[model samples]
Target: MRLSTDSPSINDSKSSNKHNANELAPRPTSIKDTGIQESVLLELMLKHLLSGGVLTKAQLVNKMGITGGIIQELFDKAKGLAWVENRQSSAEGHMRFALSEAGDRYAKQASMKSGYRGLVPVPLAQYSKICRLQSSRRNPITFEMLQNGLKALVLPNDLLHKIGPALNSSRPVLIYGPPGTGKSYLCRNLNATLGDSVLIPYAIAIGTEVIQVYDPQLHHAVDNNNESAQLDLVQGHDPRWIECKRPLRITGGELTAEMLEVQFDSHSRTYMAPIQLKANNGILLLDDLGRQRISAKQLFNRWIIPMEERRDFLSMQSGEHFEIPFELILLFSTNLNPNELVDDAFLRRLGYKIHFDALDEPLYRKIWFQVCEEQGLSCSEEMFQHLVNDYHHLLEKPLIPCYPRDLLGIMGDQISFMELKPVVTKALIAEAWSIYFVQA
Candidate 1:
């Protein structure tokens, strides 16, 4: 079986293999490769020392993902300042250094200012540069690539044609359709088709303040451990950057305007990069568009300038404003009509407005059989015809793609309860339909 490049198991196995000397060459051998200031390194060193009384130079290198030479250089500087002292010789013949009283006092001050004690953050300038380098525009998705990406889904040929060009437009898409027509599902699958991975920063440093960007919940780290290790041997990536599958984030009715701005965590003395920033190199999907707590007009107006300029302005607590790349595939999914939610001005901003209508009889029947096959239940042509001609046509109920899967699940439950064999019979389906739909 083929494993995805982003699989952690694959990455771990690769990382475990011995690497060639030239391959090892890519690993960060100096502070410059880390893309962090020396002062920040020094502060990080001090903070790390606070954990254990003493640490060998090698330990510091592993903890900080820095080179030995750089760690030694920082250690010498700290020793010169009377911040650290060689406490004892270790079994490996390396001297273990402990923080001096002065160093301990300095570390306390550093901790008070910002409690961040992880791998060093890349400077905002460096992060912005990296973002530009990995910008989504540079890699235009082709129709063939999208076809391969969504090959698993049973998408119609016409819809596939529409999706291909919509993705190429590099503008926000509005997928308006009735509920259960797979608007959100299609957007999600489109994200899967984006192909290669991009690196995302754990956090970014803007002057003294740090904005955390890597969201554990959102960012999926690629496991190509061997490849990453080999890559490091030849040329090291900044430790601050994580190798991740391009993010595809979705927010629904619960979304609010406040979420669009930089969220400052006073307790941590740091900031959380908003959803848009986190989705910089990926797709940002606003599912259920008109249903947000904030009005659809409010959201549309807020995005107008940014969408036009292809850049976003974010502010820190100090009111310092900066422009960040708005390089992402923006998607808006809604069951509500776009005409009702957005006017011509806002509509113009949306590149492709695709509509998903209720499924027709033939497609609905195919999906019914597909669902029955998946559920390990025998498909009955007689029963399927009964549903279409009796339950649906008789009642004037439109065919929804989701009904097969949902009705099948309901039927499965009833079958289990009554201790009957799992099969789609006309009687069984009728009973499930009665339970599924009630008089309003």
Candidate 2:
């Protein structure tokens, strides 16, 4: 069945899929580390060496069929990734760089992993190859980039910092907390921290002449004709790929095997890459891991192969299978037991599974103030004590007034309607509680 272009949605719901279940079963470690570019570069060097250990600089250039600058760049890179030794020939007194044993072994392993049977012949048309190679290694999000990409509310600094590094540097992170505790907020902000370069806000395809935004939901022209059609068209995107930047994408509960699989677009006549596929080189935060209609165990099961191999399988509607860069910081946020969500077997494979317990009292206090200042309310010690003693302590709430602030927000709005003073009183607080809090 066909799915929506922006997110995965089916016109029919006959075929269902499992999402999250049995946390402790230890998910099959869908922890595929992205190292495609490195493998390619290593193979390039290996081919250069397999022919002969002693090629002159000119021969090396001609063999790889690349320019001098490219050769030197590859040479320098080889020196770092592969072991090389220099020897002076007694006959000609020229330096020859040859792969060390470790380098040879590494090259072979890299070649095998990349599905390269032998060496790829150097061709000028290989430019697309380089771009695709870069796609996997590319950084999809960055720190400053995050600041510009969000419309959702930002969570506390502590929460952001606690889970931020794991988004890129660590493995799949599990963010667990009760509902309305800002779990989704953290996921939304992930787009902001993605590297700006991968954001590709806009692009004018060399073939089409039409300017297209890097926006995945919109851009579909992949050929010269489409580009040409789009070129004369108005609605030229701003901050084009060269300028526009949005790398991270958040998916709450729309993840599916089909989303993980490939779909051929009859309209576009091309394969519509899945969300995670597009998330390559960026963060793909799976918000509400356990709340999906799909079963947790089944979702974990689908991801098992990808986690272990750091690569995933995608099948066309015609049943043709292919692989793509699963290079993304996959984050799973849940309030349910991590063990209950997945089997222990599945959980162990996850790179880093961190459970975010309830926020402590002091942190709760700090966040409450943040809510006050942003909402423009004058909160005094008397007011604060009244809250802790009269309401917060009595209700045994999470202390930060996550819901309390929401209620107060309503009161603040009423203030605008009634023209009351900004300094909120117990009456205002009571009004907020009535509107926001769910009484037992």
Candidate 3:
């Protein structure tokens, strides 16, 4: 069974809604959208269902990068939207879902909106709201705190001045560079440097209010109106630890549009936010910019509204759109050309674009020696020069300061393997580079 994009619904048609109010509906529902991006594989399965087929959780996990928990989240959302109809086993014990009238509409909308996208910066506007509340709750970081953090990084004088005002104001800061450039490291250190405790929200879900259907503890006191009855939110076993430390959501290229949306549960009927929502009030680093499945332009287009306005709109699966704050330090790390990646209009949203060029010879030497001393790798100046001058020529690559750190690591592994003395050698460095980095 395969779904067709051109030919509209061949079977499931939206049923007529007649009765209201006093009519005893099968289920009282709140049509909220679950902003989770349905994976291509899942979409394929749904398309198959439209043509007439079924999928088990096992088949789902095998096809998609999703796990049982995430799949359940999807099912719950669909069930709430009334997009699926449960059918009893005709001759087998297994149960399956068929596409419903609402499901067809949902599928069509999903197809129109779906495309594997990047999650980085997509949730900036959403996170902004979360941080505003989080910041207000934690109180703002004073100037002293900000200055101390900047000093600790030993940032260049020019860079410090450029970043200081941005920090003082509400403008977002971006750090662009290659891998191992310490982008994430410096951002994480912001919490400690700020001298403030960033609050991490424990998303206390109000269960799919099948009139309060989601029961986490089997005996939970979930109340929407009475702010007094606080739901005890626990991710895993025992439900004790709060896990409330402010988090830095480190996302690679696995980001998408749906992830920026809100979700609603059908069975247990609750909402689970995307990772960016969870990373609210903290730093969000799009570690590898060009590596995502989504085009850099497509992603930048969606972010334009949120970045400029400091507010992003989130659509509920129920088709309701709401605005959220865009609180976050959006860092785009890539090795690609900036001009080629994003245009002028897109670039304007970012307050600061700090490009970290390859370290010069002097800095390279300093970094190399610092790493070597820290790692306890024994090698004389003569040996270091020989390796740098020799292998670098053979490799035809510039002296990346990171090379020494990588070479030291390789030497350690070789020593451990061969049972050699505690020292590094040109041979070890050469062999490791050949194995790991010599591909290109």
**Among these predicted structures, which one has the highest TM-score?**
1
For all candidates in order, the CA lDDT equals 0.77, 0.51, 0.50
> After aligning candidate 3 to the native by TM-score, how far in Å is the CA of 369 from where it should be?
3.0
Local accuracy of candidate 3 as per-residue lDDT tens digits, 37-123? 344324544654554456554344333323345546556766776767776654456456677887776556554443211110112
lDDT of 2 at 193: 42
Q: Per model, how many backbone clashes are there?
A: 18, 51, 27
Supply the TM-score for candidate 3.
0.56
Give the 10-residue window scoring lowest on summed lDDT in candidate 3.
Answer: 13-22
Better of 1 and 3 by lDDT: 1
Off by over 4 Å in 2: 1-165, 168-170, 199-214, 218-246, 265-270
Candidate 1 residue-wise lDDT, 172-281, digit = tens? 88888889997887888876676556778778877766788989899987743222222122354544567777899899999999999999777876688989999988
Question: Please, what are the lDDT tens digits per residue for candidate 2 over residues 1-440?
Answer: 11111223332211211110111111111111111244354465564675467555445544432333444556677777656655565356645667778877875555443322221222212212322433422433333334444424444455544554565453566777677676666676654444232322222111111112134453322221112212111222211112213346676676665665554444433344566655555566777787675677887888887666657666555455555445556778887788888888888878776655456666666666777888888878788678777887887766532654676688789899889888878888888777777776
Which 10-residue span in candidate 2 carries the lowest summed lDDT? 17-26
